[model samples]
Target: MFSRLFDALQGGSGVGAAVRRRQVDAEVPNFAEADDVRAAFFSSALQHAKSSYDAERDGYVWGRTLRPSYALQLHPLNTVQTYTQKKEFVWVGLTAGPWFVGVVVLQFNYFAAFSVSLYNVESEESWRATSRVPLPGPWLGGQWVPNEKGEFGPTSAGHRVEFSAPLSTHRARLCFAGRSVQVDATGVVAQQLPNGKSAGAQRYEVHAVATLPEEFLGVVFPLGPRRAALVSKVAAAPLQSPLKLRLGGTEWSGDGYLSMDYTRGLLRRETRWHWASATAPAGYGFHLSEGAYDVDNKSVENTFYAGGRAVLLETRVEFHKVTAAAKVWTLTGDGIQLRFRHADAHDAALHVGVVKTDLYHAWGTFDGSIRVEGAMYKFDRVAGVLEDHYALW
Candidate 1:
């Protein structure tokens, strides 16, 4: 049977050199101070963050599944993570079939070293913050350099700082909340600010963007024990969310201009993970990836994008979790033979960093579900629909 489905997708011999020879160093937990939770999910064009990525405590499981054409990450600590000033935002979407409202504004020209956070999930109020002090840099007292590698604000007669009004074109819309919401993109730059107060559930007045995020939200990691080093049992633990994905089949768009190698800091960028599936005749097949933790090459860059082709999977493949369940809530991985169901839900949670998780929930997939995390069950059917190649650096 195709070599027993290639020995259960290479548990056989050649699909990641014997599962990277049994990975089990498991040691990247030392988080405290309430886990230093500082969330981020500003892909703006009219808000979208109710669980762009969450870290549910209880053992461990960090999430990130943004789709503008790829950005899936699954990590389980062992030390060695790096996502150095690696910005990947480039929005301008306005779809219909999949519902993507619009409203993009760009001009965050460095205010300080860096900190407009929300590149994680599990909201906690205090949204849209930018520092470094210097104000009006695209005009009135504009200042702050570098544009291609971070640092914004700077236009001084260079003219260029327009996100227009008119209720910001229907006040843009594309929300997806998760807690003490705030959605950041930097104080509108010319107007809009002063709306924080509420805590935990308030998603309105949307419209906010500055693009550059999708390379799996740059760099994310969450393994076990509520990470950050035990997370002090994460407020009494209960976390265990690792599998469950609906995965909107395929929709496309690209506006290019993302390349680099940083001499080797590695951004040897390519940017183009376009999709086109739309399947769900009970369909289920997935092996996605994204990476940014070469921690001096300890290994794990399983970066690959199918259909649009971008295979890189083989950073020593070895992300074994095997069970991951969630009844009626609809989530079954490995044992249940991979399956996910949910396509338009909001109110998300799951933060293992700076911890602000309230369990978790995020859906927006037209079908074709299957999110595996520590899966393995073979008896009768022996799990069909197989075709694997997963690597998430």
Candidate 2:
């Protein structure tokens, strides 16, 4: 199989060659206290005051409570104890009303990618499709395991995608050929904080969410040393309910909101990133990402969702373009400021030799505003999506 995947990539030992291997003096782990990792998922109880993966009492926990098992032996690639790379992916975005949808499913065990997109805010028109397969293909199945219980379904090209949550009824489906999208939500519950105060379910206290739990930015750091660990979970919410879209063939259903991205460790072998997702319908929204699994800024997956409550932006959101044919892009930090006017885009690329991508999916309109805490949220033009990625996995 491609010479044992190029002898596990020129024999440097997995996790993308341990991200340029060079650190091993031990002593790492002890940086999770930014208010207990932002109240560690503010509690409804998926429980994790420490449950697994501990280089020593865990490193990050904004909540999903660790508990992922990795075992790839053959130590000494410079010790992180045989750090194997296990990355999983799930990205979903929908803004129902006038229609805006996106779905992504990726599994890099050998190769996998699927994408479906549509946008139409009173007739601006857009449709996109993508599919790449090559890893014991069955579409995709299992292993984002934290609190457990998840499902994925896929057969082959003429695509159909499915995601199930099993407990609080989180379902998603996207069909091909004729185009389709259906989403049913009821996952996070417990809300009431426009100062009316109700948000209770134990711990971390109030900042509500009614149709969902919109606040999941789980973290676990260390990429060049300290056991090389890296875990992630990102969420953007407003899938408040009622969303059904079928373009060109006309179907359209109401309401919108959903943005999810999840991850698993040992990455960085030429990974680039700049992501943005917007949501609205009174529940406001934002989810901005910064390059390759945190470069030095420790923890930052930048989030700010209100009305559905989930605010954590310790500053660090910057993506400007003076080149790459700038179509007008600027994302600032610290109390935030935004401006993205690209209007229609969905380009995907794959070089296939060692796996390469040029992924771009710009679909714009986000006029600016975000101040959290001191309260000041706004985004005049709204309607979002901006992902400019480059990967060599």
TM-score of each model, paired residue for residue? 0.21, 0.29
Model 1 regions lying over 4 Å from their true place: 1-179, 183-365, 373-393
Predicted structure 2: lDDT: 0.49
Number of the top lDDT candidate: 2
Query: How close is each model in CA RMSD to the real structure?
Result: 22.8, 19.4
Candidate 2 TM-score, true structure as reference? 0.29
- Total clashes, candidate 2? 2
Instruction: Mark the regions of model 2 whose C-alpha exceeds 4 Å error after superposition.
Output: 1-4, 7-85, 96-104, 108-220, 223-264, 267-278, 281-284, 287-302, 305-373, 376-393
lDDT of 2 by residue, 286-312 (tens): 788786544346235677766545666
Candidate 1, residues 1-393: lDDT per residue as tens digits? 454333322211111222323334243422211143212212131123222122242122232222222111112211122121112121221112122221223222211111111111111112222222222222211111222222111111111222222222112211212111111222221111235232332222322222222221122233222221100000000112211111123223322111101001112122112111111211122232222233223222233222222222333322222235321122222222223222211122323333232312222232223223433222221111111112111
| Residue 151, model 1, lDDT | 15
The local lDDT score (0 to 100) that residue 241 gets in candidate 1 is 23
